[model samples]
Target: MPRININLSHQIVKKFGLAEVDDFGTSPEFYFASSVNLPKNSAFANSMKSEVEKYSFRPTLHAPFMHLNLGSESKEIAETTRKELQWAIDTAAFLRADIIVVHPGYTALPEKKTIEHTGWLDNALPNLDFIAKYSEDKGIKLAFENIFDRDPFSLLLIKEAIGTSNIGFCFDTGHYNIFAPLDMQDWLEALDGHIYEFHVHDNDSTGDQHLPIGEGNIDFTSLQNYLVSKEISELPVVTFENKTLDFVKQSLSRIREWEFLKT
Candidate 1:
């Protein structure tokens, strides 16, 4: 069965406590979405590590993504991006996390016709190479997630250019429902072997609402069928990115009913 994880930030854990997470019977995917959430000192890091260890939970991490552009043309912006990502890698290593999720740093703009025209890959290559090697050395995998990408091609390009097993894709269902120009099946096929994890949430296709699975129109049954067809020996980590505990529990119950996940 795929390892189940729930997305929680430092603020969330501080507010609700890990006992609630323990009750849910799922590991956590710690989301450090901003610099404020990143641990500032060893004491803070050790505290979190101790709490997580107490529960015997193996964690994953979501790197800071706000206003971070790995492909930025500005030298300062590029340097800052790499620095923050390196911080995430170091934190993940300290926490003994299996992988850290990263944003691909692409957004749709009117001036650019395609990713190549935007030069995102070109500007991002050096930083991507650096981070990929750095994370690999720490025994951590980088799962580049889809944000404003219109299709799988941009991520595919990154994978091909980086050409490293330590780097893989994290398919976000809500992002795909809202931002992807192609269908879910197309994404699954294109990123077939490279999928390392999933940010599973649902939205109405009108917005990134992060609703429970059944409340939205995403065809999760198709996702299950794809996994079954592949006869995968190891399933990717499934992290619920819902907004609340109720939604996470709802998604958990819904996914547990899926035949492929039941095994």
Candidate 2:
């Protein structure tokens, strides 16, 4: 059976408090949405850590992704990206998190003719290599997530280039539904051994609605069947990305009915 988790941002916890998280009945995949939230010594970090310890919840982490590009051509930007990612890994270590998710730092450009010509991967490789090594040293795994990717090729190339056991993929269902030219089965097959987690949510195929599981057009039944067909003894961690408690509850109820998940 898969371990279930919910996405809880630092901003949300700070604004609302952690008490409500108990109602979700799952471990949290804490999102440090900004570089400012990655400092390990901050009062907020300490307080959050204490609360997590008290609850005895095993956690995963989502690293800061806004305005940060691991593939930036500018040397200064690359350095800053590395620093921020290192801070994320350090914070994850402090929180005793096993997996920290990050974006692939790829944004499709209209002028770029090919994936290689886009220059994102070439520029990002060194930084990715550094971070993957750092995460491994800290006993933390890095899950590179799909954002604007039209297919799984880029992520596959990244996994091969980095060539590290600590690095894997986090398949974002909403992004796949929005941006992918290929089907979910293609993605699962291409990324077979590389997938470590899932950022699961629903979308209308027109936008990233982050709706409850059955509220959108995504076929969750097919996904569940694929996992079962593979006979995967252990399933990837499923992190609900629904933005509201009600939506999350709805999604949870829906997933609970899938017999494969109940095992």
Candidate 3:
């Protein structure tokens, strides 16, 4: 079966706190709910993590995206990011989990230093080094995700520099919806053995609407074909990162009943 996971956002947990919404069937990919409780205090986060433990589903945690950036330009911001990620790492360890999905940061300022992308790389590589060593010491596998428009070489280089058995890539389908330089198939092929997991969601291409499968324009069939070609279908675990509960439930149902995997 294709491993289906749910992105556990804080919003859903808040609803759970109010009145538990029972999950009747299995949620394939237990995508940790970073979108919902991203701004909560450590105590609150721990509480949510406890709730996650209550579920019978298997989980993969995504580090929070707010107030931190792994790919920050400023050294101070970068160090702060290191600390923030460490918090998530510690949380995962406490939760007795193995997988942690993380984003690759980006630079957006026009007036920022023209370090030529490679120069920007010089400053960021050290941060990746710190994370690689830290995750190793903790005995955790940190899956660095591939996001679009962010420097591609930077991600590849970081993967090379932070050489460890615990590190690999978490390919997000929506992010690939916008991947530059290489086409999506080529990109998927390049990361074949290196891909540790996936953030599965669909978008309209114009915007990241996080639509459930078959509702949006993402060609999941084609994507599945590539996964089969790579022999990834066996250990498949895809976290539906959509926000709507209805959509999340629908995504779970469709993936469980997906025709792509049936044949």
lDDT (10s digit) by residue, model 2, range 131-232: 999999999989889888887777777787887798899999999999887888888888887778999999989998999898999987657876676556
* Deviation (Å) of 107 in candidate 2: 0.7
Q: Quote the lDDT for 218 in model 3.
A: 74
- Local distance difference test, per candidate? 0.85, 0.83, 0.64
Error of 2 at 79 (Å): 1.4
Looking at model 3, residue 244 earns an lDDT score of: 73
TM-score of 3: 0.80
Model 1 lDDT, residue 53, Cα: 87
Model 2 quality (TM-score): 0.93
**Maximum-lDDT candidate:** 1
Task: Sort all candidates by TM-score, best to worst.
Answer: 1, 2, 3
Better of 1 and 2 by TM-score: 1
Regions more than 4 Å wrong, model 2: 109-114, 229-233
Q: Which stretches of candidate 1 lie over 4 Å from their true place?
A: 40-42, 109-113, 230-232
Q: How do these models rank on lDDT, best leading?
A: 1, 2, 3
**RMSD (Å) of each candidate, 1 decimal:** 1.9, 2.0, 4.3
